[model samples]
Target: MAHDVQLEAITYETKEEVPQELKEKKLSWQKLRRYDSLDLESRSIPGHHHGHHSKALTRSLIFRLAFQSIGVVYGDVGTSPLYVFASTFPNGIGNNDDILGVLSLIFYTITLITVIKYVLIVLKANDNGEGGTFALYSLLCRYAKVGFIPNQQAEDRDVSNYELELPSGRAWMASWLKSALEKSMFAKQILLFATMLGTSMLIGDGVLTPCISVLSAVGGIQVATTKVTQDMVVWISVVILILLFLIQRFGTDKVGYSFAPIICVWFALIGGIGLYNFIQYDPAVAKALNPKYIIDYFKRNKKGAWVSLGGVVLAITGTEALFADLGHFTVPSVQISMCFVTYPALILAYAGQASFLRMNNDLVKETFYKSIPKPIYWPTFVIAVLASIIASQAIISGTFSIIQQSLSLGCFPRVKVIHTSTKYEGQVYVPEANYLLMVACVAVTLGFRTTTNIGNAYGIAVVFVMTLTSCFLVLIMIMIWKTHIILVLVYILIIGSVELLYLSSVLYKFDQGGYLPVAFATVLMIVMYTWNSVFRRKYHYELEHKISPEKLKEVVGGISLHRIPGLAMFYSELVQGIPPIFKHYVANVPALHSVLVFVSIKSLPISKVPVSERFLFRHVEPKDLNVFRCVVRYGYTDVQNEQEPFEKLLIENLKVFIRDGFGLPQSVLSNGENGEEIMDVRQVEEDMQPAEIEREIEAVDKAWHAGIVHLIGETEVVAGKGSSIGKKILIDYAYTFLRRNLRESDDVLTIPHKRMLKVGMTYEL
Candidate 1:
């Protein structure tokens, strides 16, 4: 029956040479026209043309976005004023000189790190419009093949945004560096490790930010009323943290409107109060803006001031949020907010607190509240708490974004990612991550019981992440920006030196709560490393054991297998040929679906894949077999949960390919009647006069409706008999446990249970 069933291979005829009209058009125009011709109605092709809006940054949009960014982007950094002064003077200010010096340090730290490094320089390193550690790694990986995952395709590099001019002259050093990084496996592994370490620290930031921010804010209650005890403050802070995490499910969308206004009001109130206090108290505190005071501060206080640097670093603790949350707002908006609002307000606030401390040295323990006038204490305290919650919300959202990026890059385990906003693709909520963060925050709040110790932990996580970001930024400067070698070295030297100083200061307090983030980062690092290592090993094993498509085709041709009437979609990591699971399935079942598709989903290093360029399809050899190979590509930031829509779009595109023969090289039809003529896929399909092709299309549609079954390989990794006991324990115990407990194939694929079949196999790696 298989031999009797004959199928005609649909083919098209066209010129092999390029047309004169096509050659005459500019490259940019051609690209614009091509994107314009794509079907905008298809969700699969997220319009790449949306890039235009980013390019057209109007004045009104900048101010509006800058104001709006206050709520989300600057919340964490803005609330730092609540605790910086108190944390700095935990042992009480020694003299009037110490207050000025501390204020000076806070002023310069915020200016240098927050405004200069992050706002002016680091923001430029964002991957497309997306930001974060993984986004940086993604940008670097695009220039160099350092990513451990083997899923990237050639077309991934062909993305318009991915293209860059080759380095020349001194810039050749960058190309050489990229080549060196890619050539060494050890270098690749090290790069991967650094990225994971930074990401883990970011997760730690998520836990520590909330604990410190809210505890510090609520501690103001104790300052306002001496009746409040330390335990009461801890309990109250924990309650607020619980409520914050509880409301994560409703997402930031519902409450996002109020964030901007609340934050705007908070900043305005703080800035206004800082000015009022600066004038009313020691106006001479303005002398603290001098860099000489920072040196004088260390010279006078010695080790005490050195230890105080840990607390002083608190002023810039949320600096990373400026860059991490860059995706939510434009760089211009962030820069504007920082330079005009956040930067100036922070400087004045710290100076005003120092002025207040000069006269009332005993109130150093509660500087923020003590500095406030009696007439507005209650309202100011209320605004401070609200601002702290917003700050915590920003970091929590940031944590979700980072985890989502890690999942896409294969560095993190699969977890359910809930899209929190339809308008913003990057806004997401992970249930597992949310609960874990909440628990960790509560634990930290209860354990530390004070802002001073939590500030130590917070400083460690912040400085380490900043240090790692600087290291990564060095590579990005060389490879992506192609900066002059001297400039790159100087950039690293300056940023590295500053961050290392803060890191050392923070690390000095390891016994005094600094170990919290270290422990948190270590645990997260191990999990990420184990997951990525197992994933790489499994993929390599599959590659080594994979059967060639030609061999599978010959074997199928020789056997009298039953041809079933339905579409079978085989999901595999292998992109090129038949997977071993397919061979195993055919050997056992002795049958094949009427239409077979080997599908591979790939995550590219870019921030997003355009909808028109998302799917790449080709017919497997011996077209009569009715076999097709499809690769669905996504950028790390792209949404990947549309399984049903993805399937439907693939089928629709495949039908167009079948009728119009567009995927085949020689089959591209060009209408030469006019230079302005546009070739539409639907029009080409309609122009095709093959009756048999139409019949096949209808039959395939019928088969699709009959049922589309998803076949996935369920592979178990175990050590071979020849392997060491350590390997056995690692694979059979740790890896297997993770696989069993983590999300399964159906969850990742979003495949319905009734239409899915898992074929089990074992691999000894």
Candidate 2:
């Protein structure tokens, strides 16, 4: 029978260089949809994508999807204008050399950097629209040569041996490498970059968003009343920021449903205003499409051109996150939404503000109200500020995701990553990542005291990621694209030039506290790269020293300890070496009457604990002590060593432990609280007589069923024994009864078993 392909991860790398034995197998990467699920096609769920909906409904659906993407992807850039001008002119948006320099950077920043580089070049390199550093690296690793794999393993000393049996072994090798590399290397790098940059700007945004956004909003309140103080504005903004932090616990799952609709309204307001301005003014802002104009802005503003780099790079503040979070909504949706609604509204707001500044001059009074019609302005300001706040949520969420990816790739320490969406494999929430980021963000907020000062720290992380991406992509293009050297150089020149410009701009912001984020970024990069190098060396040295397979088999054949009384379980990693870890554990704590389980756990990008993959009893006696076996699961991050989970699973498998004289039970174990114990005998003592009258000599349990008991303990884990308590309920009470009946040739109890008898029931037949 065919299994669900949706649940399977197919490898994409070709097997060309591998031996003929491994050649028949194909490897394809994950092809999960934006919202992949087998059940979404059902007719019952309300507000589903389709189910006899009208064209108006369809438009609304598209609107909701598109608008959400805008809030998620482009919010940071759209909100930049709020603080960019203020930072350039501390007193006000006055026309100083710095002010014009910042404007030139901001204007051309949107053109040469954001439009020409990101949309026209980088986004096109997406792996089927799934972005992120890991996915890209994985695609690269698929084409990586195999000599890399063997050097890491000691068992492959004779390379010719792999030529004899390579296919099944290749599968096993891929599994181990993916696990180690992703866990130790990939995640840390991703997280370090996110934390250093995201945390810094977030702090800046936190301090700045409340004061700037609310002050701008409350300043609008002055049009209604003549009395308003800066003190009052600060108080109100502080209250709003507190409220924002307070809501982080509820998670965005429910909030996401409500958010999509409101975002549509917010964008509609901006779009309506933008279209109106485009019609009335025939705005020449459209001239931003020409990269030459951006070049001219830099040339004309030569003296402070370096300072302008940070401001220009602001247009691409959230680009790294978009690539980092491409695992969420589809790239088409994010890009389309940005182009149609988010970008248009942001441009209109900028143009409208420019016009207001032109007409009134007092519109630059640190109050956002003087720029538009009073009634129209108040409502629009409310929506715009609210949209900005929501946009911060994506940044926060993306920060967590990036950190998680970094940790997985071995760039950082092991931190928890939680998946928020049950259906979406990519929707994650890391509490450790979240709190650390919050700390960083708040610190920056306090340090900067205003968004204007904090805005400088914003573009560093994305620039680093983008610069690294360009380097990596250049190598890949040279390897894969077959492009001419001149063309490649031209591409690198365009990318490098813009990157250098941004790097210089941000350098100006350093004294203003931009170094804080850069410093953090540097620390994370060091830790990730350093730890990975150490781990690889250790693992390589350990595995390489292992004995050959012939020696291992000889050792296994010579063991006389099998007759020892106890269940001996081996801790099996099933890697290149034999099960020596199990032997070490057994030698350390040789428990008597025990069942040993060699355990193997498989974890996917998705988080659900797979139950069916659990394997069961194989009796492997070191010399023949009747050792029962199993492979139990305690989840991917469970800290219990091999002995603990296996012991617990063995205790639960007690019926099988006695039934097949201790056989395996896969299905019966997961039936209920414990599982439906096999309805059979439980209490047959072992017959020691080697000469029975033509009878099977194995001792069997007359299997009895045990009922499940539930309890929650109130205790906290002190560091890493994982949980202090693992509850085990009664799984089977009758496993020993049937065997006794069969031995005595007595009739089975028909009445007591009919109603599902509980404990303490005494009925004499």
Top candidate (TM-score): 1
lDDT tens digits by residue: candidate 1, 1-765: 000000111111211323344435554223323221111111112233322124788999999989878888888888888888878878887777988888888888887888878988999888777788887887777667777543223344445566444445656777789789888989988888888899899999999999988998998888878899999999999999999999999877665546999988888888888888899999999998788988898999988888888988888877888888887789999889888888878777887888888899998888889888899999999999999999999899889888877876676777777777876557778888999999989988888898888898888999988998898988888777778888877876877788888888889999998898899989888777676777777776766677766786785665578888899898886654556777778878887788888887767667777776777676665656777777676777766564327778889877876765433322334455654334444443454447857865886797798789999877878888898887777788877777788777667666778989888888878
Model 2 agreement with the true structure over 1-765: per-residue lDDT tens digits: 000001112221111111222122222101111110111111111122311112233555655555666656665565555544444444553332233334345555555556666655556555433465544443344333211111211111111111111133234444444455445655434433443344334333333333334334444455556686545544555565556655655565544435555566666665566455445543544544445554665576564555656645655666665565555555556667766665666556555544444444454544234444545876777776676666566666665555554443333444445555554445555555555555555555445555555556655555666776676566445543434568778977877877876776677678776776667755555544443443233333324443444553343444543322233333321222333343333344333232233332222121112232233334443313333334333221212221224334444454333333322122212222333322121121122122331121232111112221111111111112232231111001121222122211001011112322121111111
> Which 10-residue window of candidate 2 scores lowest in summed lDDT?
28-37
Q: Give the per-residue Cα lDDT of candidate 2 at 468.
A: 64
The lDDT per prediction is: 0.76, 0.43
**What are the runs in model 2 whose C-alpha is more than 4 Å off?**
1-68, 88-108, 145-246, 274-301, 360-362, 365-369, 483-487, 526-534, 537-574, 578-581, 592-765
In model 2, the number of clashes is 67
> TM-score of predicted model 1?
0.89
Alpha-carbon TM-score of each model against the true structure: 0.89, 0.61
